[model samples]
Target: MSRQGRPQDTRKVSGELFSLTYGALVAQLVRDYEKDEEVNQQLDKMGYNIGVRLIEDFFARSQQGRCHDFAQAADVLTKVGFKMFLGVVPTVANWSAKGDEFSLILDQNPLVDFVELPETHQGLLYSNIICGVIRGALEMVQLEVKVWFVQDQLRGSDSTEIRVKFLKKLEDAVPAGED
Candidate 1:
Protein backbone atom coordinates (compact mmCIF):
# COMPACT_ATOMS: atom_id res chain seq x y z
CA MET A 1 0.00 0.00 0.00
CA SER A 2 1.11 3.49 -0.78
CA ARG A 3 1.36 6.23 1.83
CA GLN A 4 1.59 8.95 -0.77
CA GLY A 5 -1.55 10.92 0.08
CA ARG A 6 -1.91 9.89 3.72
CA PRO A 7 -2.14 12.75 6.19
CA GLN A 8 0.87 13.10 8.47
CA ASP A 9 -0.76 15.28 11.11
CA THR A 10 -3.87 13.24 11.76
CA ARG A 11 -2.73 12.11 15.18
CA LYS A 12 -4.42 14.42 17.69
CA VAL A 13 -3.51 12.44 20.80
CA SER A 14 0.03 12.06 21.97
CA GLY A 15 1.34 8.53 22.41
CA GLU A 16 1.73 8.89 26.16
CA LEU A 17 -1.66 10.47 26.62
CA PHE A 18 -3.36 7.77 24.56
CA SER A 19 -1.59 5.03 26.44
CA LEU A 20 -2.42 6.56 29.81
CA THR A 21 -6.04 7.02 28.85
CA TYR A 22 -6.32 3.41 27.78
CA GLY A 23 -4.59 2.27 30.94
CA ALA A 24 -7.04 4.20 33.05
CA LEU A 25 -9.97 2.72 31.15
CA VAL A 26 -8.65 -0.80 31.66
CA ALA A 27 -8.03 -0.19 35.36
CA GLN A 28 -11.57 1.08 35.79
CA LEU A 29 -12.96 -1.95 34.01
CA VAL A 30 -10.95 -4.24 36.22
CA ARG A 31 -12.44 -2.55 39.25
CA ASP A 32 -16.00 -2.61 37.93
CA TYR A 33 -16.07 -6.20 36.72
CA GLU A 34 -15.82 -9.12 39.12
CA LYS A 35 -14.12 -11.51 36.72
CA ASP A 36 -11.17 -10.81 34.48
CA GLU A 37 -12.96 -12.48 31.59
CA GLU A 38 -15.82 -10.03 31.88
CA VAL A 39 -13.38 -7.16 31.81
CA ASN A 40 -11.81 -8.59 28.69
CA GLN A 41 -15.21 -8.91 27.04
CA GLN A 42 -16.05 -5.35 27.90
CA LEU A 43 -12.79 -4.14 26.48
CA ASP A 44 -13.35 -6.10 23.30
CA LYS A 45 -16.86 -4.78 23.02
CA MET A 46 -15.60 -1.26 23.43
CA GLY A 47 -12.95 -1.85 20.82
CA TYR A 48 -15.55 -3.25 18.44
CA ASN A 49 -17.53 -0.06 18.70
CA ILE A 50 -14.41 1.95 18.15
CA GLY A 51 -13.42 -0.14 15.18
CA VAL A 52 -16.84 0.23 13.57
CA ARG A 53 -16.29 3.96 13.56
CA LEU A 54 -12.57 3.89 13.12
CA ILE A 55 -12.84 2.16 9.76
CA GLU A 56 -14.72 5.10 8.34
CA ASP A 57 -11.91 7.39 9.34
CA PHE A 58 -9.49 4.85 7.94
CA PHE A 59 -11.22 4.91 4.59
CA ALA A 60 -11.31 8.68 4.47
CA ARG A 61 -7.70 9.13 5.42
CA SER A 62 -6.21 6.10 3.74
CA GLN A 63 -8.06 6.59 0.42
CA GLN A 64 -7.80 2.87 -0.09
CA GLY A 65 -10.07 0.63 -2.06
CA ARG A 66 -11.20 -2.96 -1.55
CA CYS A 67 -8.60 -5.65 -1.00
CA HIS A 68 -8.45 -8.36 -3.62
CA ASP A 69 -7.57 -11.20 -1.26
CA PHE A 70 -7.01 -12.05 2.37
CA ALA A 71 -3.24 -11.84 1.93
CA GLN A 72 -3.58 -8.36 0.55
CA ALA A 73 -5.96 -7.43 3.30
CA ALA A 74 -3.55 -8.67 5.93
CA ASP A 75 -0.70 -6.77 4.33
CA VAL A 76 -2.69 -3.56 4.10
CA LEU A 77 -3.82 -3.93 7.72
CA THR A 78 -0.34 -4.49 9.14
CA LYS A 79 1.22 -1.85 6.94
CA VAL A 80 -1.42 0.83 6.65
CA GLY A 81 -4.02 0.38 9.37
CA PHE A 82 -1.66 -0.32 12.26
CA LYS A 83 0.77 2.39 11.23
CA MET A 84 -2.00 4.93 10.78
CA PHE A 85 -3.55 4.21 14.18
CA LEU A 86 -0.85 2.87 16.52
CA GLY A 87 2.25 4.35 14.87
CA VAL A 88 3.66 0.88 14.52
CA VAL A 89 3.61 -1.84 11.87
CA PRO A 90 3.66 -5.39 13.10
CA THR A 91 5.26 -8.22 11.19
CA VAL A 92 2.76 -10.59 9.59
CA ALA A 93 3.72 -14.22 9.95
CA ASN A 94 2.67 -17.80 10.72
CA TRP A 95 0.36 -18.21 7.77
CA SER A 96 -1.80 -21.32 7.70
CA ALA A 97 -1.45 -23.70 4.77
CA LYS A 98 -4.88 -22.74 3.48
CA GLY A 99 -4.00 -19.03 3.56
CA ASP A 100 -7.02 -18.35 5.76
CA GLU A 101 -5.09 -17.64 8.97
CA PHE A 102 -2.16 -15.48 9.99
CA SER A 103 -0.51 -13.87 12.97
CA LEU A 104 0.54 -10.32 13.64
CA ILE A 105 3.68 -10.01 15.75
CA LEU A 106 4.09 -6.76 17.57
CA ASP A 107 7.43 -5.93 19.04
CA GLN A 108 6.01 -2.90 20.82
CA ASN A 109 2.38 -2.52 21.83
CA PRO A 110 1.48 1.00 22.84
CA LEU A 111 -1.46 -0.18 24.94
CA VAL A 112 0.89 -2.08 27.22
CA ASP A 113 3.45 0.67 27.51
CA PHE A 114 2.47 1.52 31.06
CA VAL A 115 0.54 -1.65 31.89
CA GLU A 116 1.53 -4.57 34.10
CA LEU A 117 -0.91 -7.38 34.74
CA PRO A 118 -1.23 -8.33 38.38
CA GLU A 119 -1.24 -11.94 39.53
CA THR A 120 -4.95 -11.69 40.32
CA HIS A 121 -5.69 -10.58 36.75
CA GLN A 122 -3.68 -13.20 34.94
CA GLY A 123 -6.75 -14.18 32.92
CA LEU A 124 -7.01 -10.73 31.46
CA LEU A 125 -5.80 -10.30 27.95
CA TYR A 126 -4.35 -6.82 28.19
CA SER A 127 -4.37 -6.23 24.46
CA ASN A 128 -7.51 -8.08 23.50
CA ILE A 129 -9.00 -4.81 22.33
CA ILE A 130 -6.69 -5.08 19.37
CA CYS A 131 -8.26 -8.38 18.41
CA GLY A 132 -11.71 -6.87 18.57
CA VAL A 133 -10.61 -3.92 16.53
CA ILE A 134 -9.33 -6.21 13.82
CA ARG A 135 -12.46 -8.29 13.86
CA GLY A 136 -14.72 -5.27 13.75
CA ALA A 137 -12.83 -3.53 10.99
CA LEU A 138 -12.76 -6.62 8.85
CA GLU A 139 -16.44 -7.21 9.40
CA MET A 140 -17.27 -3.73 8.18
CA VAL A 141 -15.47 -4.56 4.98
CA GLN A 142 -17.58 -7.72 4.50
CA LEU A 143 -15.14 -10.18 5.99
CA GLU A 144 -16.18 -12.33 8.91
CA VAL A 145 -13.13 -13.20 10.94
CA LYS A 146 -12.00 -14.59 14.28
CA VAL A 147 -9.29 -12.57 15.97
CA TRP A 148 -7.57 -13.30 19.27
CA PHE A 149 -4.31 -13.00 21.06
CA VAL A 150 -2.28 -16.16 21.12
CA GLN A 151 0.58 -14.54 22.97
CA ASP A 152 0.99 -11.35 24.96
CA GLN A 153 4.03 -9.55 26.28
CA LEU A 154 2.34 -9.02 29.66
CA ARG A 155 1.79 -12.76 29.85
CA GLY A 156 5.57 -13.48 29.80
CA SER A 157 5.69 -13.79 26.04
CA ASP A 158 8.67 -12.30 24.26
CA SER A 159 6.35 -10.56 21.82
CA THR A 160 2.69 -9.78 21.38
CA GLU A 161 1.09 -11.94 18.73
CA ILE A 162 -2.48 -11.66 17.46
CA ARG A 163 -3.92 -14.47 15.40
CA VAL A 164 -6.51 -13.73 12.72
CA LYS A 165 -8.58 -16.38 10.96
CA PHE A 166 -10.82 -15.63 8.05
CA LEU A 167 -14.25 -17.20 8.33
CA LYS A 168 -16.50 -16.06 5.44
CA LYS A 169 -17.64 -13.00 3.63
CA LEU A 170 -20.95 -11.56 4.76
CA GLU A 171 -23.73 -11.01 2.28
CA ASP A 172 -24.94 -7.50 1.81
CA ALA A 173 -28.00 -6.60 3.84
CA VAL A 174 -30.93 -5.03 2.08
CA PRO A 175 -32.38 -1.83 3.41
CA ALA A 176 -35.49 -2.04 5.53
CA GLY A 177 -38.75 -2.15 3.48
CA GLU A 178 -36.77 -1.95 0.26
CA ASP A 179 -36.98 -5.60 -0.69
Candidate 2:
Protein backbone atom coordinates (compact mmCIF):
# COMPACT_ATOMS: atom_id res chain seq x y z
CA MET A 1 0.00 0.00 0.00
CA SER A 2 1.13 3.56 -0.61
CA ARG A 3 2.46 5.52 2.33
CA GLN A 4 -0.52 7.30 3.85
CA GLY A 5 1.03 9.09 6.80
CA ARG A 6 1.78 12.70 5.77
CA PRO A 7 0.72 14.14 2.44
CA GLN A 8 3.28 14.73 -0.31
CA ASP A 9 5.07 18.03 -0.03
CA THR A 10 5.22 20.70 -2.71
CA ARG A 11 7.65 20.11 -5.56
CA LYS A 12 10.96 21.93 -5.55
CA VAL A 13 13.64 22.38 -8.20
CA SER A 14 17.25 23.44 -8.07
CA GLY A 15 17.95 27.13 -8.30
CA GLU A 16 20.62 26.56 -10.92
CA LEU A 17 18.30 24.73 -13.28
CA PHE A 18 15.62 27.36 -12.88
CA SER A 19 18.08 30.15 -13.49
CA LEU A 20 19.61 28.54 -16.58
CA THR A 21 16.28 27.64 -18.16
CA TYR A 22 14.83 31.10 -17.54
CA GLY A 23 17.95 32.79 -18.86
CA ALA A 24 17.89 30.71 -22.00
CA LEU A 25 14.24 31.47 -22.58
CA VAL A 26 14.86 35.18 -22.29
CA ALA A 27 17.83 34.98 -24.57
CA GLN A 28 15.83 33.16 -27.20
CA LEU A 29 13.04 35.67 -26.96
CA VAL A 30 15.51 38.47 -27.44
CA ARG A 31 16.97 36.81 -30.49
CA ASP A 32 13.60 36.13 -32.07
CA TYR A 33 12.06 39.51 -31.39
CA GLU A 34 15.19 41.36 -32.64
CA LYS A 35 14.13 44.47 -30.73
CA ASP A 36 14.46 45.37 -27.10
CA GLU A 37 11.02 46.93 -26.76
CA GLU A 38 9.33 44.05 -28.53
CA VAL A 39 11.08 41.51 -26.39
CA ASN A 40 10.18 43.34 -23.24
CA GLN A 41 6.53 43.57 -24.26
CA GLN A 42 6.41 39.91 -25.17
CA LEU A 43 7.94 38.93 -21.85
CA ASP A 44 5.43 41.08 -20.00
CA LYS A 45 2.54 39.54 -21.91
CA MET A 46 3.74 36.05 -21.10
CA GLY A 47 4.18 36.94 -17.45
CA TYR A 48 0.70 38.44 -17.34
CA ASN A 49 -0.75 35.16 -18.53
CA ILE A 50 1.26 33.25 -15.98
CA GLY A 51 0.22 35.62 -13.23
CA VAL A 52 -3.46 35.31 -14.12
CA ARG A 53 -3.35 31.57 -13.52
CA LEU A 54 -0.79 31.73 -10.74
CA ILE A 55 -3.10 33.82 -8.56
CA GLU A 56 -5.57 30.96 -8.30
CA ASP A 57 -2.82 28.61 -7.21
CA PHE A 58 -1.49 31.19 -4.79
CA PHE A 59 -4.88 31.55 -3.17
CA ALA A 60 -5.30 27.81 -2.80
CA ARG A 61 -1.81 27.02 -1.56
CA SER A 62 -1.08 30.04 0.60
CA GLN A 63 -4.39 30.07 2.50
CA GLN A 64 -3.64 33.65 3.45
CA GLY A 65 -7.20 34.81 2.95
CA ARG A 66 -8.38 37.90 1.14
CA CYS A 67 -6.40 41.13 1.28
CA HIS A 68 -8.57 44.13 2.19
CA ASP A 69 -6.12 46.83 1.18
CA PHE A 70 -2.96 47.62 -0.73
CA ALA A 71 -0.76 47.26 2.34
CA GLN A 72 -2.06 43.78 3.02
CA ALA A 73 -1.61 42.79 -0.61
CA ALA A 74 1.92 44.18 -0.58
CA ASP A 75 2.68 42.19 2.52
CA VAL A 76 1.39 38.99 0.98
CA LEU A 77 3.27 39.60 -2.26
CA THR A 78 6.63 40.37 -0.66
CA LYS A 79 6.45 38.02 2.31
CA VAL A 80 4.48 34.96 1.33
CA GLY A 81 4.17 34.96 -2.45
CA PHE A 82 7.77 35.70 -3.44
CA LYS A 83 9.24 33.71 -0.59
CA MET A 84 7.25 30.61 -1.43
CA PHE A 85 7.59 30.77 -5.20
CA LEU A 86 11.07 32.22 -5.77
CA GLY A 87 12.73 31.49 -2.41
CA VAL A 88 13.67 35.16 -2.35
CA VAL A 89 11.60 37.71 -0.46
CA PRO A 90 11.51 41.28 -1.78
CA THR A 91 11.18 44.35 0.41
CA VAL A 92 8.32 46.80 -0.11
CA ALA A 93 9.25 50.46 0.20
CA ASN A 94 8.91 53.96 -1.33
CA TRP A 95 5.26 54.52 -0.59
CA SER A 96 3.66 57.52 -2.26
CA ALA A 97 1.95 60.29 -0.39
CA LYS A 98 -1.42 59.09 -1.64
CA GLY A 99 -0.48 55.48 -1.00
CA ASP A 100 -0.99 54.70 -4.66
CA GLU A 101 2.53 53.57 -5.49
CA PHE A 102 5.41 51.65 -3.96
CA SER A 103 8.66 49.96 -4.90
CA LEU A 104 9.45 46.29 -4.37
CA ILE A 105 13.18 45.89 -3.82
CA LEU A 106 14.96 42.69 -4.69
CA ASP A 107 18.23 42.44 -2.83
CA GLN A 108 18.99 39.30 -4.74
CA ASN A 109 17.33 38.13 -7.94
CA PRO A 110 17.57 34.47 -8.83
CA LEU A 111 16.51 35.13 -12.39
CA VAL A 112 19.52 37.34 -12.89
CA ASP A 113 22.04 35.37 -10.92
CA PHE A 114 23.76 34.08 -14.06
CA VAL A 115 22.26 36.42 -16.60
CA GLU A 116 24.21 39.04 -18.46
CA LEU A 117 22.52 41.38 -20.92
CA PRO A 118 24.56 42.04 -24.04
CA GLU A 119 25.19 45.58 -25.18
CA THR A 120 22.67 45.16 -27.97
CA HIS A 121 19.92 44.48 -25.44
CA GLN A 122 20.78 47.49 -23.36
CA GLY A 123 17.26 48.93 -23.30
CA LEU A 124 15.59 45.59 -22.87
CA LEU A 125 14.10 44.83 -19.49
CA TYR A 126 15.25 41.31 -18.79
CA SER A 127 12.99 40.81 -15.80
CA ASN A 128 9.99 42.53 -17.27
CA ILE A 129 7.96 39.38 -16.78
CA ILE A 130 8.05 39.99 -13.03
CA CYS A 131 6.28 43.30 -13.47
CA GLY A 132 3.69 41.64 -15.63
CA VAL A 133 3.22 38.91 -13.07
CA ILE A 134 2.64 41.38 -10.28
CA ARG A 135 0.26 43.38 -12.42
CA GLY A 136 -1.64 40.25 -13.39
CA ALA A 137 -1.92 38.95 -9.84
CA LEU A 138 -3.10 42.27 -8.46
CA GLU A 139 -5.54 42.70 -11.31
CA MET A 140 -7.00 39.28 -10.62
CA VAL A 141 -7.93 40.50 -7.14
CA GLN A 142 -9.66 43.63 -8.54
CA LEU A 143 -6.78 45.92 -7.81
CA GLU A 144 -5.77 47.37 -11.18
CA VAL A 145 -2.09 48.17 -10.89
CA LYS A 146 0.87 49.17 -13.05
CA VAL A 147 4.05 47.18 -12.37
CA TRP A 148 7.39 47.76 -14.08
CA PHE A 149 11.00 47.15 -13.30
CA VAL A 150 12.84 50.36 -12.63
CA GLN A 151 16.26 48.92 -11.77
CA ASP A 152 17.91 45.72 -12.90
CA GLN A 153 21.21 44.40 -11.74
CA LEU A 154 21.73 42.67 -15.07
CA ARG A 155 21.97 46.15 -16.52
CA GLY A 156 24.52 47.17 -13.90
CA SER A 157 22.15 48.43 -11.23
CA ASP A 158 23.09 47.57 -7.67
CA SER A 159 19.65 46.30 -6.75
CA THR A 160 16.52 45.48 -8.73
CA GLU A 161 13.40 47.52 -8.02
CA ILE A 162 9.90 47.02 -9.31
CA ARG A 163 7.59 50.00 -9.15
CA VAL A 164 3.96 49.19 -8.47
CA LYS A 165 1.32 51.85 -8.90
CA PHE A 166 -2.25 51.38 -7.85
CA LEU A 167 -4.32 52.68 -10.70
CA LYS A 168 -7.91 51.94 -9.68
CA LYS A 169 -10.17 49.18 -8.48
CA LEU A 170 -12.17 47.26 -11.04
CA GLU A 171 -15.92 46.88 -10.73
CA ASP A 172 -17.53 43.51 -11.22
CA ALA A 173 -19.62 43.46 -14.33
CA VAL A 174 -22.58 41.11 -14.78
CA PRO A 175 -22.49 38.64 -17.60
CA ALA A 176 -24.88 39.10 -20.51
CA GLY A 177 -26.62 35.75 -20.09
CA GLU A 178 -26.78 35.94 -16.31
CA ASP A 179 -29.84 38.17 -16.35
Candidate 3:
Protein backbone atom coordinates (compact mmCIF):
# COMPACT_ATOMS: atom_id res chain seq x y z
CA MET A 1 0.00 0.00 0.00
CA SER A 2 1.11 3.56 -0.55
CA ARG A 3 2.28 5.50 2.46
CA GLN A 4 -0.88 6.63 4.24
CA GLY A 5 0.16 10.20 4.95
CA ARG A 6 2.51 10.86 2.10
CA PRO A 7 1.46 13.04 -0.80
CA GLN A 8 1.42 11.61 -4.30
CA ASP A 9 4.02 12.49 -6.95
CA THR A 10 1.85 15.37 -7.93
CA ARG A 11 4.33 18.18 -7.93
CA LYS A 12 4.88 19.18 -11.52
CA VAL A 13 7.37 21.44 -13.24
CA SER A 14 6.46 25.10 -12.94
CA GLY A 15 7.01 28.49 -14.57
CA GLU A 16 10.57 28.54 -13.24
CA LEU A 17 11.37 25.65 -15.52
CA PHE A 18 10.31 27.67 -18.51
CA SER A 19 12.85 30.34 -17.63
CA LEU A 20 15.55 27.71 -17.20
CA THR A 21 14.75 25.54 -20.23
CA TYR A 22 14.48 28.51 -22.56
CA GLY A 23 18.22 29.10 -22.50
CA ALA A 24 18.99 25.71 -24.01
CA LEU A 25 16.26 26.08 -26.60
CA VAL A 26 17.58 29.45 -27.67
CA ALA A 27 21.12 28.08 -27.82
CA GLN A 28 20.02 25.24 -30.07
CA LEU A 29 18.08 27.58 -32.31
CA VAL A 30 21.12 29.80 -32.69
CA ARG A 31 23.47 26.85 -33.23
CA ASP A 32 21.29 25.54 -36.02
CA TYR A 33 20.80 28.88 -37.80
CA GLU A 34 23.77 31.08 -36.70
CA LYS A 35 21.68 34.22 -36.39
CA ASP A 36 22.24 36.30 -33.28
CA GLU A 37 19.77 39.18 -33.57
CA GLU A 38 17.00 36.91 -34.78
CA VAL A 39 17.70 34.58 -31.88
CA ASN A 40 17.55 37.47 -29.45
CA GLN A 41 14.15 38.44 -30.77
CA GLN A 42 13.07 34.82 -30.48
CA LEU A 43 14.12 34.79 -26.85
CA ASP A 44 12.07 37.89 -26.14
CA LYS A 45 9.13 36.39 -27.99
CA MET A 46 9.49 33.20 -26.00
CA GLY A 47 9.49 35.23 -22.79
CA TYR A 48 6.33 37.00 -23.89
CA ASN A 49 4.72 33.68 -24.74
CA ILE A 50 5.64 32.42 -21.31
CA GLY A 51 3.82 35.44 -19.90
CA VAL A 52 0.76 34.62 -21.96
CA ARG A 53 0.39 30.97 -20.95
CA LEU A 54 1.36 31.26 -17.32
CA ILE A 55 -1.12 34.07 -16.64
CA GLU A 56 -3.94 31.83 -17.83
CA ASP A 57 -2.95 29.22 -15.27
CA PHE A 58 -2.51 31.86 -12.64
CA PHE A 59 -6.03 33.13 -13.03
CA ALA A 60 -7.40 29.62 -12.95
CA ARG A 61 -5.69 28.93 -9.63
CA SER A 62 -6.66 32.19 -8.00
CA GLN A 63 -9.27 32.19 -5.25
CA GLN A 64 -11.73 34.39 -7.09
CA GLY A 65 -10.70 32.95 -10.43
CA ARG A 66 -10.99 35.81 -12.92
CA CYS A 67 -11.78 39.24 -11.53
CA HIS A 68 -14.72 41.28 -12.72
CA ASP A 69 -12.97 44.51 -11.88
CA PHE A 70 -9.42 45.77 -12.04
CA ALA A 71 -9.18 46.68 -8.36
CA GLN A 72 -9.83 43.16 -7.20
CA ALA A 73 -7.48 41.91 -9.85
CA ALA A 74 -4.73 44.11 -8.48
CA ASP A 75 -5.38 42.95 -4.94
CA VAL A 76 -5.26 39.28 -5.91
CA LEU A 77 -2.05 39.86 -7.83
CA THR A 78 -0.37 41.88 -5.08
CA LYS A 79 -1.39 39.45 -2.37
CA VAL A 80 -2.10 35.83 -3.18
CA GLY A 81 -0.44 35.27 -6.56
CA PHE A 82 2.91 36.75 -5.66
CA LYS A 83 3.03 34.92 -2.35
CA MET A 84 2.27 31.57 -3.92
CA PHE A 85 4.56 31.90 -6.91
CA LEU A 86 7.40 34.21 -5.82
CA GLY A 87 7.13 34.09 -2.01
CA VAL A 88 6.76 37.82 -1.56
CA VAL A 89 3.63 39.90 -1.34
CA PRO A 90 4.07 43.33 -2.75
CA THR A 91 2.23 46.31 -1.32
CA VAL A 92 0.11 48.57 -3.45
CA ALA A 93 2.33 51.59 -3.34
CA ASN A 94 -0.05 53.82 -5.19
CA TRP A 95 -3.38 53.68 -6.95
CA SER A 96 -4.17 56.49 -9.28
CA ALA A 97 -7.48 58.30 -9.18
CA LYS A 98 -7.65 57.93 -12.93
CA GLY A 99 -8.20 54.18 -12.39
CA ASP A 100 -5.69 53.44 -15.10
CA GLU A 101 -2.39 53.45 -13.23
CA PHE A 102 -1.12 51.61 -10.19
CA SER A 103 2.08 50.48 -8.57
CA LEU A 104 3.14 47.26 -6.88
CA ILE A 105 5.85 47.85 -4.33
CA LEU A 106 7.95 44.78 -3.70
CA ASP A 107 10.20 44.93 -0.66
CA GLN A 108 11.77 41.56 -1.41
CA ASN A 109 12.54 39.67 -4.57
CA PRO A 110 13.65 36.04 -4.52
CA LEU A 111 14.18 35.84 -8.29
CA VAL A 112 16.82 38.53 -8.53
CA ASP A 113 19.51 36.71 -6.62
CA PHE A 114 22.81 36.47 -8.54
CA VAL A 115 21.21 38.45 -11.35
CA GLU A 116 23.25 41.25 -12.78
CA LEU A 117 22.52 43.18 -15.91
CA PRO A 118 25.02 43.09 -18.73
CA GLU A 119 26.42 46.49 -19.69
CA THR A 120 24.59 46.46 -22.99
CA HIS A 121 21.29 45.83 -21.19
CA GLN A 122 22.05 47.52 -17.91
CA GLY A 123 18.61 49.06 -17.51
CA LEU A 124 16.79 45.75 -17.23
CA LEU A 125 16.47 43.24 -14.38
CA TYR A 126 14.62 40.45 -16.25
CA SER A 127 11.79 40.72 -13.73
CA ASN A 128 10.07 42.62 -16.49
CA ILE A 129 8.83 39.19 -17.55
CA ILE A 130 6.46 39.37 -14.59
CA CYS A 131 5.25 42.75 -15.78
CA GLY A 132 4.64 41.39 -19.23
CA VAL A 133 2.69 38.53 -17.71
CA ILE A 134 0.53 40.90 -15.69
CA ARG A 135 -0.15 43.04 -18.70
CA GLY A 136 -0.97 40.09 -20.92
CA ALA A 137 -3.37 38.58 -18.38
CA LEU A 138 -5.33 41.78 -17.78
CA GLU A 139 -5.29 42.73 -21.44
CA MET A 140 -7.06 39.46 -22.20
CA VAL A 141 -10.00 40.72 -20.14
CA GLN A 142 -10.18 43.99 -22.14
CA LEU A 143 -7.73 46.01 -20.08
CA GLU A 144 -5.12 47.75 -22.17
CA VAL A 145 -2.07 48.12 -19.96
CA LYS A 146 1.58 49.03 -19.70
CA VAL A 147 3.73 47.58 -16.91
CA TRP A 148 7.33 48.34 -16.00
CA PHE A 149 9.67 48.30 -13.08
CA VAL A 150 9.86 51.87 -11.94
CA GLN A 151 12.32 51.11 -9.16
CA ASP A 152 14.70 48.33 -8.19
CA GLN A 153 15.73 47.77 -4.59
CA LEU A 154 18.50 45.60 -5.96
CA ARG A 155 20.05 48.76 -7.31
CA GLY A 156 20.46 49.97 -3.73
CA SER A 157 17.20 51.11 -2.24
CA ASP A 158 14.99 50.28 0.69
CA SER A 159 12.32 48.93 -1.61
CA THR A 160 11.42 48.28 -5.23
CA GLU A 161 8.31 49.32 -7.09
CA ILE A 162 6.64 48.20 -10.29
CA ARG A 163 4.38 50.66 -11.99
CA VAL A 164 1.42 49.47 -14.06
CA LYS A 165 -0.23 52.01 -16.29
CA PHE A 166 -3.55 51.27 -17.85
CA LEU A 167 -3.47 53.06 -21.14
CA LYS A 168 -7.02 52.34 -22.40
CA LYS A 169 -9.74 49.79 -22.56
CA LEU A 170 -9.52 47.80 -25.74
CA GLU A 171 -12.58 48.52 -27.82
CA ASP A 172 -14.11 45.74 -29.84
CA ALA A 173 -13.48 46.16 -33.56
CA VAL A 174 -16.49 47.33 -35.48
CA PRO A 175 -17.81 45.36 -38.41
CA ALA A 176 -17.15 46.54 -41.93
CA GLY A 177 -18.93 49.86 -42.72
CA GLU A 178 -19.49 50.39 -38.99
CA ASP A 179 -16.00 51.81 -38.47
Candidate 2 lDDT score at position 152: 86
Highest-TM-score candidate = 1
Query: Which is better, 1 or 2, measured by lDDT?
Result: 1
On residues 24-72, what C-alpha lDDT tens digit does candidate 2 reach at each position? Answer: 9988997798789999999898888888878888988989887888888
Selected candidate, larger lDDT, 1 vs 3: 1
For model 3, residues 1-179, the per-residue Cα lDDT tens digits are 55678665564444456445644464465566454445545444554566556665776776456567678878887787777667679888688997767899887765565445444444334455566566655656567778876777655556788888878777883222210
Per-prediction TM-score to the true structure, in the order listed:
0.90, 0.89, 0.65
Instruction: Compose the digit string of candidate 1's lDDT tens values, residues 8-74.
Output: 8654666788899999989999999999999889888877777777888999999998899999999
Candidate 3: count the clashes: 0
Clashes of each: 0, 0, 0
Span of ten consecutive residues with least summed lDDT in model 1? 170-179
Candidates' C-alpha lDDT = 0.87, 0.85, 0.63
RMSD to the hidden true structure, all candidates: 5.9, 5.5, 6.6
| Local lDDT at 145 for model 1 | 94
lDDT, candidate 1, residue 135? 79
